[model samples]
Target: MTTQQLEVNFSELINKPKATLAGLAGAKRILLRRRDAEDLVITTAARVEQDAQVMSAGTRMFVALVRHDTAARSLLLEIIPEAFPWVRFLSEESVRAFAAELAEVLPAAESLGNMSAVATTIAAWQHTAEVHSDPELLAALTTDRGEDYGPVPEPGVTG
Candidate 1:
């Protein structure tokens, strides 16, 4: 049986702190809904630590599996194309390289709790596959232009 998550409006939380907190008695966490802002989650410190520990252990196990088991690595490669159809855009060698780099980055990112880095890594590889899939773009990129290029503008800056 699935237990419903306790939900309390943000205004109710501020107006009736005791009652809002009391909802945690029957739930592991309470989702604080906000009409005008991002929603918030209220959970105990113990729950947070427990989740971190589980994630750490799971990361370690996955890293070990990929590193030591060829079958596991092969399975990952086999499923990767199915999981992300964009991977098919990449050559076999690029796909293998992407998998290796992902395996290396994923454990480190999880260890540091930096999921964004993992997302960026995947996006970077996907974009590379996209470029490789386009013959004209790939040719343009691979062709060296001897002309001097102007300096790149800083990110998020506009003229």
Candidate 2:
């Protein structure tokens, strides 16, 4: 780290009240870097200015599930696993943690969890399947000495 970077006290920096620093008052965003590659936190002016959504239906589910309030939690624990196989490894505590993070960031998240799934390559794979489904086109492309499937070359060139 540079001397300038090592000089600041991040703990105290973050402890400062909002709008306390005159120099940074006009800044649109701020970021704090922790030891080495350990952690990073960035807070935008807009994110801080916007209201946080603490109470929502999704958050209520997490709270209820964590407290084991009723049979509903049991149904969720079973149904979620059945619907999403990836949820199989997540215990109740892990699910609670995930839900907590989700709730905390949901408001700041730009997409509202529309296309958040990482395993969403099904559409790309489906397009590829459709492209290669025609046997005649596939055979024509693979055949070297037959009618060309794509643009044909000049007379002297090979097929």
Candidate 3:
């Protein structure tokens, strides 16, 4: 499978009352806006799958590093309960710091500064994680189901 990266503006995608989304007419898309509606749209399902693998691999490495590395994770989690109010914030900050450290050795984090506001950025991250981490949450968010999830059972729970 092959994938192509397309640079597009949100204004262009949402130009009409129709969906610019994937279907018999188009390919899958990931909308990312960094500035002034500047967006990167991944317009192929195959590409999406490939990108997902790349992202997942990167995420796993990051988790492994922070989860296993003592000193690095400690500095960020010092206040534990204070500095990090949300998991997303912690992840973003960890990535930020890691990128900064990476920059010392190699130029990086060049675009991190252009990221959206902390609150909104963290919110989106948390929202996506929530949807992926829990099907019920995704269902509830996507479609209103009057049922409460009962604290969302722990992942992989066994009776």
Candidate 4:
């Protein structure tokens, strides 16, 4: 399917909703750019559902191929570094582990119509590889400090 998206300032969406929506007549989606916050995508619920279905089908096809074909799995592992040069910072074992985890997460994320799981998995692995790439950071993180620190508070929560 062809994707047509138009970009407009977020203010245009808020101040001139009608004109902003008119842009959608020529494009399937509107990308609202926000200077101080994350950008947003505006599209019909039907378009969103169609995208989810396409993603689910494609993810399932890939999962099936990898499960049934050893060659496909090997090819995926072999191409990891090619696709993401940062993976080169990771050891072979870590790279394989990253691939395995990503493969496991992709289908589940797609089925849920949410890519957060897949994104989180990739970010975690990427952070691991980044740490591995730095000798000082890796040593500091891996070493035992032998000190009893206070209990850590939950992230994003304040006392």
Candidate 5:
């Protein structure tokens, strides 16, 4: 059987009231702010699929993207964390270092840990950034380099 795809349009979704979006199955919400745009607060819901092994519960996950008028480019900051919440508290210094390192090595996508993996990843990124002080080089590693950068995880590891 072919699975049907669900398309989520951010512009339309943000219009409905929170009560409406919260009613959906697998709904999760977040508020986003952008450095360049007017404040935009939105809520979203999504269905998650589950994995049998690595994931204790089912592996399906959903998230809400929030941002202001910073242009789609600035929206990238929201995407990084929404994709990897585990790296939230890695310290500003550590995150900058990681972003710099990621600019070099893992330029595409990398698996990061949830709450469990933040510490290790922070250390690795710090080391890499220290060795290489090129902001442009680090920016290259992310899809949103030109926009506001978000938190970074450790090297050789992700949640």
Candidate 6:
């Protein structure tokens, strides 16, 4: 079981007036914002290595539009590898554990009510499967891993 990194950018998916960060604490799906002209949705998944780094962090094989809705408040959809299906690897227990974590992070609302369960199911599936190597995923995630969005030219700060 090797860890892999995956990521997607959907900046064009968001349409809301304001962007909000939201996620399913114990789940796999994390909603960024509602679909709009300027919105983007990026999803990255990886297997944790012994050093906690993604084994195939640089490779990205799966990408798609999980959702497109104006009424939806949060991004709704679980990311899965197109080449390797999750049902092949994860166990029931693993899924439950993952779901529990996601519930704590996801927003609390009627529209997001089912996210917990969905995240749990996805987690269960991922527990057993071997993720492929993806360089694209690694590059994207690593580049913005610790990026700062604050105003520049702060005192004592150097680029």
TM-score per candidate, in order? 0.72, 0.23, 0.29, 0.85, 0.22, 0.19
Better of 3 and 6 by lDDT: 3
For each of the candidates, give the backbone clash count.
Answer: 0, 0, 0, 0, 17, 32
Model 3 error, position 136 (Å): 37
Return the clash pairs for model 2, or none.
none
In candidate 6, what are the lDDT values of residues 46-95, reduced to their tens digit?
51132222211211111112123422212222332233355334454544
Question: Which 10 consecutive positions of candidate 6 have the poorest summed lDDT?
Answer: 58-67
Backbone clashes (count) for model 5: 17
Tell me how candidate 6 scores on lDDT.
0.36
Please list the residue runs of candidate 5 whose C-alpha ends up more than 4 Å from where it truly belongs after superposition: 2-75, 107-159
Taken over the whole model, the C-alpha lDDT of each candidate is 0.88, 0.47, 0.50, 0.90, 0.41, 0.36
lDDT of 1 at 112: 85
Alpha-carbon error at 147 in model 5, in Å?
Answer: 45
Candidate 6 residue runs with Cα over 4 Å from true position: 1-88, 108-128, 131-159
Worst lDDT run of 10 residues, candidate 1, spans 1-10
As for model 6, its CA RMSD to the true structure in angstroms is 21.2
Worst 10 residues of 4 by lDDT: 1-10
Candidate whose TM-score is highest: 4
lDDT of 3 by residue, 66-151 (tens): 65787757654554435334444335565455333432322122123221343454466456555656767666778965777567
Determine the backbone clash count of candidate 6: 32
* Best candidate, lDDT: 4
Q: Give candidate 3 misplaced runs (Cα > 4 Å).
A: 1-42, 75-121, 124-159
lDDT of 2 by residue, 1-159 (tens): 211122223554668744333324444344454666554434445644352333344544565564565565555555654554454444567544444454344433423533243223334433434445666766676678855488879999997
Error of 1 at 25 (Å): 2.3
